[model samples]
Target: MAEWLNILLRSIGLFILVLLFARLMGKRQTSRMTFFDLITVIVIGVLTAAISLNLVNVLANGLIALAVWVFAPIGMYYLSIKSKMIRDIVQGRETVLVNHGKVLEDKLMEVRYTPEDLLSQLRKKNVFNFADVEFAIMEPSGEVSVLLKKDKQPITAKTLGVSVGHESVPQTVILDGVMMDEPLTAMGLNRQWLHTELEKIGVAPENVFIAQVDSAGQLYVDLFNDAIITPKPKTKDLLYVTLKKCQADCELYALGTKKKNAKKIYQESALELTEILDELEPLLKK
Candidate 1:
């Protein structure tokens, strides 16, 4: 019974110690664990397990081993940042597998990677055709970063000489039916403005699951029951609404005016409405 109690207490203590050391190691070590980082984790696990099981009866020895494993990588990481040679040796430099659509056979053989392995990694990057790849680099963490040929890349606004204006990340103004006052205040918006925007989209404050305000001051609201009923207007629907308002105005001007040039003004409005409908027709087909 005393042996079982000892094991339990030691196990709990080691678990807490491991957790504390892991937190001190930082998030990058886990998320982007290199070959050296993996070795450090395995050694720590083995030492902790042996110590907890009383296989290594000296608690001080186990702790000393843990301290060395934990601090050594941290010290090396700092040194790696200071020295490029050490960084290259410790982290391993990125290897170019493919350059300008040509595979380096010698480099492939040196890395012990087969052509099939190269193709597999390329496919993972959504590049099935090797001819489309401008450069394929095997990063130190084993991730393949592929740069597609310029012609093969997706077209952007800049490519077409169009202005897209500045863009910024949308700020969350509300989450889970709760108003985030700090972000709303930071955005120079008050609860009254939020209420008005919610009303425009037919969403109540309490029913909103999440809400974000874009850089353009456009409020995007998602309600808890969105799957059943979407409160926001669709693109085509909004276009149709604008078209209807234009038609109503044209009729009002035609009826209310006694001037001779009133017909020309209504005709111009009708022409603009026709163009809007033409744009809406393609979206409606989708």
Candidate 2:
């Protein structure tokens, strides 16, 4: 009974020590383990078991051991933060795997990483070929950071000289065919307005896959079924179409004439585009 009590006490003490030790370490350190760190942890486990078996004085020995195990890392963390050299040695340094689109063979060998390993990490970031990378950095935590080549870099419509306004993450107004009341209220929208917008887009309320609202008060709707994704409409001549209408309504408008007037015209055209996008979105549900 006494031996069992000792074992139980030691087990609890050891767990408490490890928990405190881990909390003192950073999230990245715990998530990514190193050879030295793992060995040190194993030593702690062995000591914990030995103490538990009453090899050492149960109360005094276990308390001392637990205190050391808990506070040692906290001391090391202080040193690491104060000393740059210690920090680099403890956490390791970020290694450059590729510099200016060229792989550094010597650097790879020094870090004990292979071309295959680096390539695999790149693939995780959606880059398959070496030529597609401009720079690749191997962080000390075993994660890779990649920068793509100029030509391979993804270009949005804005980058391609297309006139696009600012974009932001859309707020979900409905999810899984259920109304999201909080989100709708946050966006100053309601279920009634949502239903009206869906009807305008020829989408039944039940058929909506997801309904999102942007800060610009535009509605984006997707369909639940995959068979009906029709491409969105593209205007061949937005300026000409809008200007002709604007001139008829108020003759004081041209594409570049009045700066503030041009902005208003642009906003109106953008609203129309968003409306058309809502109509076409239901077709591409798959």
The lDDT of each candidate is 0.84, 0.71
Give a tens-digit lDDT track for model 2, residues 135-237: 9998867688999988898997557755444456679987767778898888888889888777666777677778788755567667789787733422323
Best by lDDT: 1
Can you list the residue pairs that collide in candidate 1? none
Give me the runs in candidate 2 sitting further than 4 Å from their true place: 13-17, 32-59, 161-286
User: Compared with the true structure, what per-residue lDDT tens digits does model 1 show for residues 142-248?
Assistant: 78899999999989867986544465778899899998998888888999989988877677888988899876577777778857565543544565677778877
In terms of TM-score, which candidate is strongest?
A: 1
What lDDT does candidate 2 reach at residue 137? 91
